[model samples]
Target: MNHEFSVAEVMTTQGGTMCQYTEMTDAARKRVRAMHNWRRSQLALGNVQNGRNNYNCSQAANMYKMKYDCDLEKSALDYAKQCTLTPSVAYNQGENVHVGPLENDKTKAIATVGEKCTHWSTVIRSSEKKGYPGKTVNSTFFQAVKAWWGQIFRNGVNQRMIFLQNLRDKPNAPIAWSQMAWALSTRIGCAVVNCQSNTFTVCRYRQE
Candidate 1:
């Protein structure tokens, strides 16, 4: 389902090339989608390391590859352009937001978002007792990854099992992570909005 957008263009200023995006191009969408699925695949294959003890992580038996949703992108773009540095409370969607130094290059901006996954990818011990201690991560991509992948290992439960518990533990649990790894969630959309001094990279996932 493609939503049409007027041609997105780049403009050159004294500082550098600036992305005056009307919407992300198909290439941008594909890049973001591939980055996410690759991470998910790594986890599902037990290739990810458990930051605690270099332990081999458990594989997800039913992790689904993700698709890009134009609708999700539109919704994410609308909110990202606001540059509020906050999550979208009105839409109640699965979201990850990252604020970084202002980057005018769209490609670099998107790559920076991908880089945040490095922080999101590894799972480690925290101070929490419930096994998965939630930290304050500025509502960024790192936080989402922690919430999604950390708890499964932390609690010594299968990913699918924790997801069921997450459904009942909403508003308290870090739902963003679960949403990212949700077995039934097959779609995602993302946008990178460059404000004057910062860039807001937001990705929204379909909830199942």
Candidate 2:
């Protein structure tokens, strides 16, 4: 006698395979929990925390029994094997990328969720030209400069005088030049101005 099955029949037979594998995985989890409980019990009985120490041989015997009965090592090996045999479609079903925001600012981190940026420099340059006020960069730079020097000084003695002097020779400086000056000053750790005519002087926290 010869036996053959149609494609639909074969698919129907294989449909239950996933349920079976799921049951096996559940069984492995149960075994892991049981072994963990047994280990906890042994540790509770004044046994040393070391796994290899043989000071309490009876507890060791219990551990060995649990290990063998649950076949924890073998179960782990089987689970790994199942992972390797997972269908590509199933494996890729829920694949997604997650990006996190910058540390201090919730609104300003450049987070690429799925694809890596290939031309980050161009992106940054465009943003700068477009006057994108990145919150994270602005906040961190502001805090660093504020901690090192007091407030941003716009008067004659401040570094802005020198920057404006240099810009005076160049073509029309952008309206954002002052903003750029502030950013540059923050970067170079110079945000304080000294007053020579006053007895009481304001000082900033020096954060060298």
Candidate 3:
């Protein structure tokens, strides 16, 4: 039997495959939640407290104003909101599934979805970019995320902290569309998200 994948199963010149979008949102939410979880931690530790924390406390209650939600801290709650509220399924579908967004929609989508799409291949080459001392390109999802994390997260965030923070119990940011394509090409697969001008960056999270 000669079984063949449909248009949605394979990536094309147009954009990301259906599976890629699914992976995109999934990876994105986890990552953001993880960020919030750690940010909350930093607040508790008084690391980012600016002038607070004369005394050292390792937990949130002792450090924060005690703003609690069903036992979770404001940061954790906020993390939940971000994950729940953010768009999960990519907007377009079917033959137009791989279609990229229009130039104008780039900013709007960024605001609404908190994530924008782009090509995964470009970002993969980043291993060769400056600040990335890795001798070779084409890194793994973890490595790619590590390299781009600094660029995406700056406010005094360092490479060491990125790895250290995820150790806590929170979901990491979601895998982006572009990253999704390369990260699991042989698996669920990927394709162009839309045919409109590639105005968006694949799976880029908005800063602040």
Candidate 4:
């Protein structure tokens, strides 16, 4: 897939202003939820590795199982439709977005019901881009959420007495992961939209 991104907003095409919308189907949503819970279960079971060195990370004592929320999906879709790089989710919600060229033939019918439109491949070539070094990019929406959960590799549970508080002060704090594991955040919602030649994905988590 191409790394070059499109500057055209989801609301406007290169030729004119218009909006095209596509949404996740029931099957897609179920798969997304399964992906999330499976990754979280890995951490809860201490079966995760650090992206930095493939080192083993400690486990979570009580990672909550996540549920899909249509309200959050609506909120995420509301922002995703804009297809902006900047995050503007509600103050009490956490958000993650990915933008890139739509290349995989499977994703071409992303708007169609029951289409196999999940997962893609990419490489994260810079630690500077992601605040840590890694060979693979979390190209799937579920993998994107898993990336947030991966902060344990860098900011382990023993880092501080109040980890999340200290983490927020860091230059490249893992806010997404923190939110993902925010014990109280039991709900999530996500959406994907095609903007001409690019794909925009956004996910929202309930925040405490």
Candidate 2 collision pairs: none
Total clashes, candidate 3? 34
**What lDDT would each prediction earn against the true structure?**
0.48, 0.21, 0.24, 0.50
Query: How many angstroms is residue 161 displaced in model 4 relative to the true structure, after the best TM-score fit?
Result: 8.2
Model 2 agreement with the true structure over 1-208: per-residue lDDT tens digits:
0111111111012222222332122332333224334433543353422223333312222221222122322232232222122321211011111111123222322331111100000001001111221222222223222221221122122221334454434443321222222211111111111111100001111101
Select the stronger candidate by lDDT from 2 and 3: 3
What ranges in model 3 sit over 4 Å off? Answer: 1-23, 49-208
| TM-scores for the candidates | 0.57, 0.17, 0.21, 0.61
Against the true structure, what is every candidate's RMSD? Answer: 12.0, 31.2, 17.2, 10.8
**Over the stretch 1-208, how does candidate 1's per-residue lDDT look in tens digits?**
1122211221211221113334455555655577679778887888765434446557788788988877777777777666665435535456666544322233233333333011111111111112111121112233334445564444333333454554435443434445565566677877655444444556777644
Residues 1-208, model 3: lDDT tens digits: 1111111111112322322232123232343334434444554454442213243222234322211121111122222222122333332210001112233333333333322222122112111122221212111122333433332222222222232333222233222321221111211211112211321112222211
Backbone clash total for model 4 is 1
The list of candidate 4 runs beyond 4 A from truth reads 1-22, 50-55, 103-143, 146-162, 169-172
TM-score quality measure for candidate 4? 0.61
Pitting candidate 2 against candidate 4, the one with the higher TM-score is 4
- Give the C-alpha lDDT of model 3: 0.24
Report how far residue 94 has shifted in candidate 3, in Å: 32
